[model samples]
Target chain A: AQSVSQHNHHVILSEAASLELGCNYSYGGTVNLFWYVQYPGQHLQLLLKYFSGDPLVKGIKGFEAEFIKSKFSFNLRKPSVQWSDTAEYFCAVKAGRNQGGKLIFGQGTELSVKP
Target chain B: EPEVTQTPSHQVTQMGQEVILRCVPISNHLYFYWYRQILGQKVEFLVSFYNNEISEKSEIFDDQFSVERPDGSNFTLKIRSTKLEDSAMYFCASSRLAGRNGELFFGEGSRLTVL
Candidate 1:
């Protein structure tokens, strides 16, 4: 079984500040990584995903994540953030072959972007 | 874009009672899943359904739980007897297929409260 670890439990940032959320998984084989955000009253929305090829992947709203195979990490980042970004962020990973691939999610990090 | 939708934003059930959580995944999606998140805990995978059968499930999905797609559109999870620990946010997700390219789309989630 795979386990996801997200070190940052809560993060507070001012508008325009740089952002980074650490995500690490336990599996060593092939895996798919994703970042999902849940605003105060909205559904979970995809931030970005990483499957293969390039280690760095860009997502919507200027968000990006880098898959570091050696570290077993795929950390989410953004050069700058806004007040609208306040939400709960979850990092997930799906390991092994695709047949009914299920996600293993981290404990989630609550991010508050102060205006 | 297409989206997954869930019913009864919030549900309260008594201990030992049965409760069903409903979901309507996006059209054309072939894989469906149910995940639960206990307060302040990681989101846990419950079960995955495809071709109208369960393809995969986690230890968290015991005999007390079952899934069904009665019609072409509605997918449901039934807890035969609710327990206090069953209180959590239940999220429904669907994808085009299992494995490699299966980027899941999730619903707003049904907050279940067992009293």
Candidate 2:
């Protein structure tokens, strides 16, 4: 079975600190990557996604993810973070680009930013 | 901005009883999906429906589970005989099937607790 692994379980950072959450999947074939955020008392929302072409993909709210085929990783990054950026982040992947493929998600990372 | 909406934000039910969770997808989305997240766990895909048929389903979606589009706007998931383990937050998502980047929009989940 295909699976995604998120390296960080919990992270605490001060405002304006850089952020990086690691995501690695165990799949050999082509895959589409996604990063989702669930803010406090809110539904999950797509932060960014990567399909093809550029390995570096930019997403909403100053979020970006780099899909590195060599490492089987799509890591989310943000250069500067705000207190409101605190949320639980999830990494997800579809095995192929086929329509309606089942999505596999990793255990999420809970981020806490201190003002 | 369009979004998916779910009914019954929180449900408390007895074990062995039946429960139906409702969702109202975006007006234009072609694909609809149902996912579940156990507290403090990863979100797992259950089923995907399109064109009034099931496009794909995960192993977690067993005979006890069923989905339906009863009308133009409502999609629902029904559990025949809810078990204690069935307690989880169920999320409904929809996305337009027209583009390569089919970013799914999810609703504020309906939390179910089987007592």
Candidate 3:
């Protein structure tokens, strides 16, 4: 079975601080990676996705993720985060072929950016 | 922009009662999906529907749970006999295609509270 693991449960940062959230997946075949974000009272929205292109993918709201196939990791990064960027982030993966595009999500990471 | 919509932002039902959560996926989407997030737990995929039938389902989607696209636009998840453990936030999503590469649009979740 494919599973996603997010190393950070909660992260606190000051405004303008660099941020990186670790995500790892256990899947052997080809996979798609994604980063989704949920504001306090909003729905989960896609931030970025990686299918078969470059390893580094840029997303909305100044977010980006790097897909490292060898490490089985796709980590989210932001050069400088703002207080408005505080939200819950999720890492998801879809195993290629035969899986019917089912996305397995990791336990979310709660990001608190202090202004 | 078009977005997925779900009804009854919150639902409270008794054990043994049947609860139906409704969703209206984005227009023109070809694939529908249901997922649940228990409080303090990871979001888990329940089922995926395509071509008016179930294409894939996780173990969490057992005989007690079923999904249907009754009309042309509404997709629903039905729980035959709800249990306390069934209490969670249910999310509805849709995509234009089915594959590792497709992106899913999710609705603001419907919270289910079974007592």
TM-score of each: 0.98, 0.96, 0.98
lDDT of residue B87 for candidate 3: 98
Residues A16-96 of candidate 3 have per-residue lDDT tens digits of 999999999999998989999999978999999998789999999899999999999999999999999999999999885
lDDT of 3 by residue, B1-115 (tens): 9999999899999999999999999999999999999999999999999999999898999999999999999999999999999999999999998886569999999999999
lDDT of each: 0.94, 0.92, 0.95
Which of the two, 1 or 2, has more TM-score? 1
Fnat for every candidate: 0.80, 0.60, 0.80
Question: iRMS of every model, one decimal?
Answer: 1.3, 2.3, 1.1
Q: Give the count of colliding residue pairs in each prediction.
A: 1, 0, 0
Leading candidate by lDDT: 3
- The collision pairs in model 1 are A98-B99
lDDT of 3: 0.95
Candidate 2: interface RMSD in Å? 2.3
Poorly placed runs, candidate 3 (over 4 Å): none
Pairing residues by index, what is the TM-score of model 1? 0.98
Tens-place lDDT per residue, model 2, A1-115, is 7899999999999999999999999989888889999998789999998888999999999999999999999999999999999999999998754646467899999999999
Residue A49 Cα positional deviation in candidate 2, in Å, after optimal superposition: 0.8
TM-score of chain A of 2: 0.96
